[model samples]
Target chain A: MKRVGLKDVAAEAGVSVTTVSHILNNVQGKRINAETRRLVLEVAEHLGYQPNDLARGLRLRRSNTVGFVSDEIATTPHAGQIIRGAQEAAAQNGLMLLMLNTGNDRDLEDKEIALLLRHQVDGVLYASMYHRVVEVPQRLASVPTVLLDARSDDPAVPSVVPDEEQGGRTATRELLAHGHRRIGFVNNIDDIPASRGRLAGYRGELAEAGIDFDPSLVVTEDSVAAGGYRGSRTLLGLDDPPTALFCFNDRMAMGAYRAASEAGLAIPADLSVIGFDNQELISENLFPALTTVALPHYEMGARAIFHLQQVIDRAEPLGAAVHEVLHCPLISRDSVARPRT
Target chain B: MKRVGLKDVAAEAGVSVTTVSHILNNVQGKRINAETRRLVLEVAEHLGYQPNDLARGLRLRRSNTVGFVSDEIATTPHAGQIIRGAQEAAAQNGLMLLMLNTGNDRDLEDKEIALLLRHQVDGVLYASMYHRVVEVPQRLASVPTVLLDARSDDPAVPSVVPDEEQGGRTATRELLAHGHRRIGFVNNIDDIPASRGRLAGYRGELAEAGIDFDPSLVVTEDSVAAGGYRGSRTLLGLDDPPTALFCFNDRMAMGAYRAASEAGLAIPADLSVIGFDNQELISENLFPALTTVALPHYEMGARAIFHLQQVIDRAEPLGAAVHEVLHCPLISRDSVARPRT
Candidate 1:
């Protein structure tokens, strides 16, 4: 005897497969004749149809579900936007998004990925709170996987990251456009990819403008307000101070604001400031409303899912990995002004 | 012939269950004999065993998994700690946690919960970004469900929430201990539960101290910095100004700090401030650092999972619903000080 399926019951009962599904799953949107509903149920019972989606998933190897494994993105201020982007993108492609937060622990990540595999997730999306290169777990390599705001050492693993260098260039060029010949950059330590990329962009922009790179004006420290405070103080205390200040991130820019206030300097009128990662909590509510660059967090998330969908549609692990770097847009606010020449 | 299982294969191959599992799952770390692993694989192949956990889950009616459906918690800044608490609690009892971010959309939440049900999740954990009363989805009532950082009107559903009243009392008590009798209050609007509970705590603490409640000193507004700033200004402009200010939240407290600064009033020496909700980004980074009450987010999550475990262990819907209210602790920092008399 052939194994009973939903189609067999649908054919025998003279009902559509959707009708059989609605009756078995108890989905209540549609209305059907009572007699037809009873007939469909009877035929399903007669054929011994199990309505076992688990069995179907196992046989077809497509659960129509994707696992999202994250290090810290899910619990950050950026979590809302990133999830909105990924969740909507996944839904567009008829797949469910199952999320897991590993808290940057390799052991916990291993456990979570194993669990996802046991559940037979069709593909995996590994995202991080910040943009950087990361190691892909061996368990994930077997599935069609995409990294969001992160990268794996393995060339085979595809990734989508923000263009930090372009963001830095945009910030510097904006100050330059305001006729500031001497600019100071309050940067983060170079160990981070974001810091490195942004610094390169800053230097590249200055060089392009025929302005001699001033080592005295560049200060690097932790990506915090205190770091920004100290960096701003040092730049202002220089023999020839910069009229414009560019910070690596919004937090650092907030620190610069405090330092400028303590120094009795009014924003834009005396010192212009620009920041990166337009964190709304800081930038929007700040006294002067900071001008900054928005990290492509939401876009990165959406693109990762779109790429994962393409990868999962293929029969096997993708042969050629795609590394897509998206651009960061500048958010101009009240913080920028022409230098007092 | 009896249906082949992992136990049967382990007994026939004369190996521990762990070894058989490691070989099948391809989990790294355990050093098993290569020949023994090969023998176990060969025996399992001869018995025609299908490694179908989904089928097993269906037969057992318990997937050994819990579905955590969240409206906004999974995509908020507090997502990390809450998830950590829930995930750790679930792992302690041999259960996998599969998460879904519903983005606060009812239709999407309905779809996600349906998918979780299809996967035979043993229990469900519905959480929110912040504490509030929520409507329990009708489909969730069928399973052993618990609300984390939220409450439901339905008595049958268990819930865990932070005790905001205790937090408010704790904040007020700190100021009272510093010899500040005439205190100003910047409160959130009365409609929100957090605001109501916190205000009640503030009044309760003042009553305990025998300080007459001065309606003139209390100003309610939105739970933001601007609200705190305006409230502080109003209180300070009064005939007898308050020596200290207790804000409903950290954001409001930041506004109070600005008001004090504008008046050339040094923190601690001239005007003391205390805030609720120890949001590190706002509280810790603020100059002098804010002293605020820490909401019991992690504990609420852990307790809810523990409650769900008990419900699942009972093998039926719980008869009595548990509403656990955990306490909030005050984090003392430099912002609080003795009044200048």
Candidate 2:
């Protein structure tokens, strides 16, 4: 289990370590014979010799490392897909990620960035667990940085976020395609991009289908399961209740399920329900598996690295910041169906 | 927002960059007046200078980096806590983690270890997403390595894992304390350590209470909701069915809930149920919420780094590998109650 080094390869090939190093590194001016070069390579391959990346990186003035600094990302379920996506893309490009969780502490973030820079990382990824507006740290100004699952007011900084409006539209369109015209939208009361964008998408999609937006059918509450329960209860208790329910997230949809059951409405028979944020833990385990709109978390992570790499490799600063927004796909399960007559 | 360097501090302090470097780095045996040293330090502090860790690390032969190699840790809900624990602990010790996921592919794992070695990481954390027995990868022999949320068959390798048998005893004892003698155990069909350990704990606790082991009360199925439902239904149909049920996991406990509802039984009133692996998404959202056992994912992660640091700092090889077992605490919710007597 000893690390195979140049000396081992050279000794096995009956050549000096310098010759092996020069041949393996492909020193352009060296006049080594083709046979010798081939023999050194064969011996290195046979010995599974791995060149020291740190020494190579130092000589090339590139660390082959990207610093990934996140605010409470590692605590959320979505952390996995986003980090995994970035890691896989980085690995494919012969790079690794140095992860530092700041726990949303600005002071700690400043220190973390300083630490990342001290390690000579080629670039840093400023990531947020969920889509939000974030300010790039001042210390990060010197290094190439790209925001993941977040955006900034300054248009000149690159960022990658999920298209919330598009995701909302996709969810509503699914219900509409299933012949659900009278749909109750159980929305979150938060004044964030998700709430506003999803609501806009719901209204726009309803208008497209020649259905007037029913203000009474839309109820806003907390975003958790209890919030969904209260919202759904209010909607179902209306004098003219909607036939279908479009929940803000899977947790809310979970609450909506309870509301329907209490009202003696079996899913897709007496009522239908669709949700957003396809958290597989809830979406898959629900009695009647939940149908939800998938957040492009993994894609956002991958694309952030892709954009960051482009910025790092470019000689000139980007003419304009690339604010890329990815699409959300519909995950169809057992939740949605045609409205009952 | 520009990076502060020795030259900037020296220029501001009316001194040479070389003088600033020597004073700041505290190079021994250099002739310098106390006034000059004091002035250089003040200027460096005012300019917010940070010493280059990479250069310092090269001199010290320590990278201040730990390679975290895991098989699909980030893909699970538990990924967040475990990673956060390790990251927080590493940060406390002026270290960062270089994460590489292998997706359980041996070839990829081997390549990842090689990559970690090339980066000159002081040590590596070989982690598994779940508790299981794993063989130490041969490539990891060159680095100080510790297992996280997993154990090694080789007694000489250090590891930190949750005590599954203790967790089982805790869960069963809770139900027993609630005055339930006839407790049905809903077990997973998988022959993993969790299954074996939990079952053993259940039987041991029951025997301690002077109750005979009843094979008929235990039913094995898939470790998911559907399996829980099937297992619970079978137990409920018994001529003299148990008044309480213990599910192997929260997903299966979800299924048990459905079975109880179909049988017109209310939780804790008609049948008391307790689950394992307190996945908040499932355990918290379930009606009345589920009382379950929480696996010490975060603790395992933190302890693994703690043990790895010791191995790295020790002058001599460890005489005996430390295999630390963490405790699983019972999360009391509304799931269990005195057996409706």
Candidate 3:
């Protein structure tokens, strides 16, 4: 069936196409009487007229279009929630999203951002797979932009990222509350922000618990299953192995579980363990389901879209760039318990 | 910095906008001289003119745009790879995608499709998360449409879907080759096509191995971690438990691991297990790593977009609807092993 247009609505309502456009598009509606406005709207609704968004978008200075640029996010299972949340939030505000998946190629990203600008997207969301500092692309300055799950060195650009330090504290505290001391930390390298912040939280919790920091109990590893396994082995092989361990993320924690299993130590009963990044795929399925801190990818994505809208509406508002550090709440499951004293 | 337009290139090339449009937009090379074409192209490259895709799209009978409509496929992690493949394939063809995520609301989907129709999308890809028959939206008839990972009652519409029966057979064969005579099957309900096909494959593999069909060996359960756990418990509680188990999916396989652990059986040592859907998040991280059949979500997606382009280009070819059943290849890991003699 042919799509209903302004002409069809006008013919049905016995009015001029300009009158229908003026009333339906809300352009110069003062001249249109209420009865005429009602008649035009009723006819348009009955005919199912879909006003050309691009034409109206130009007149209203609102494209009703948002551009989403991501690096390998579309393929990551754990992070797909971010897109889902952003889509829902965009729809609630009458916006349609056109997504560009760049797969982390800087040149492709540059081209994609340039294309989005050419489209005159109302706003742009640059999302990354993890919390890291990214160099701001010069071309992104042309539109209202926000970073999701990533931050920028340029303090002027706004970012919505997870509070990793808080997550570390939450995970460590859960172990502490389980009557554990001499806790081990299977950490990522210190070069990244997450490691530095999480390590600080780990140290702070240890100090608060009156447990002196033990350099022997910590092992640095890459953020993968093999890294977690190796890290766990190093910690378990220590002369004085800690009663519990806090892994940097869930994937690492899976490796830790392997180490514990290899050593003939049962979870919770023999050695308690806590993890971060509650990726449901691993955390929910792991034997004795893992207790870990959540990343809030969905919330961060929703908040960024909401913030981008605010950024777009502002007219030279004076304030510091918004840096939202949303909470990474602890999800308690079967992974934590009291140490065997 | 201002975005360069056709007008900027026209003035720089010392030619009319129509001439610049003809060369830059590839309107008609025969009408314009080669020198003028070369000068206009050189000036366009130097001025960094970004051609208006919408306007040029009209002359070429191509919108340079494809519409992707999904019913919660964007939300489900298992299906996100589908979008990833489609995006990459679309980009390779110089077609940008405008996605509509309806979250499975039929009314919202109807409206979203109406919007896409109004935009004059070159073609449409209607994707579903599961392998099931869906009613083709009446409005989709106007555009060249292809179903991704979904089928329709009307045979005229083409679809690209996974071969679930083959997947089931592949998983069971992997277990049988490991020297298992009694293999247990944990399946989903029979109403779904996947379940029915997989069960047939399971029986097919067992029959090929010269084993009698044991009705007591199979248990139908929900496709989740809890379901796998429950199904495993029922199988193991038998007077003589099977040495091997084949789970419907990775999530169910996880529960199988839990059941083995509780029963004091080591994976691939005493109770060998095989799974379907190599969801890396679960399969890779599972204690022994799961061996399962892989769903060709990415290939299905990529193929659908490529097929839609074919359907769009074909000039009224008469034939039966194309129904492509893709292979679900097996990913060997550490899950399967020889049973105790």
List each model's interface RMSD: 7.3, 2.7, 3.3
lDDT of 2 by residue, A120-195 (tens): 8988889998788998999887778899988888787899988889888888999999898889999999888888
Clashing pairs in 3: none
lDDT pick, better of 1 and 3: 3
Q: Which rank order by DockQ, best down to worst? A: 2, 3, 1
lDDT by residue (tens digit), candidate 3, B260-292: 988999999999999887788778877788888
Question: What is the lDDT of every predicted structure here?
Answer: 0.82, 0.89, 0.83
| Real contacts recovered, all predictions | 0.25, 0.68, 0.45
Task: Please estimate how well model 1 matches the true structure, expressed as its whole-model Cα lDDT.
Answer: 0.82
Pairs that clash in candidate 1:
none
Per-prediction TM-score, chain B alone: 0.85, 0.95, 0.95
Error of 1 at B273 (Å): 1.7
Judging by TM-score against the true structure, name the best candidate. Answer: 2
Residue range with the least summed lDDT across 10 consecutive positions in model 2 chain A: A52-61
Per-candidate TM vs. native?
Answer: 0.86, 0.94, 0.89
**Regions more than 4 Å wrong, model 2:** A1-24, A31-50, B1-20, B33-49
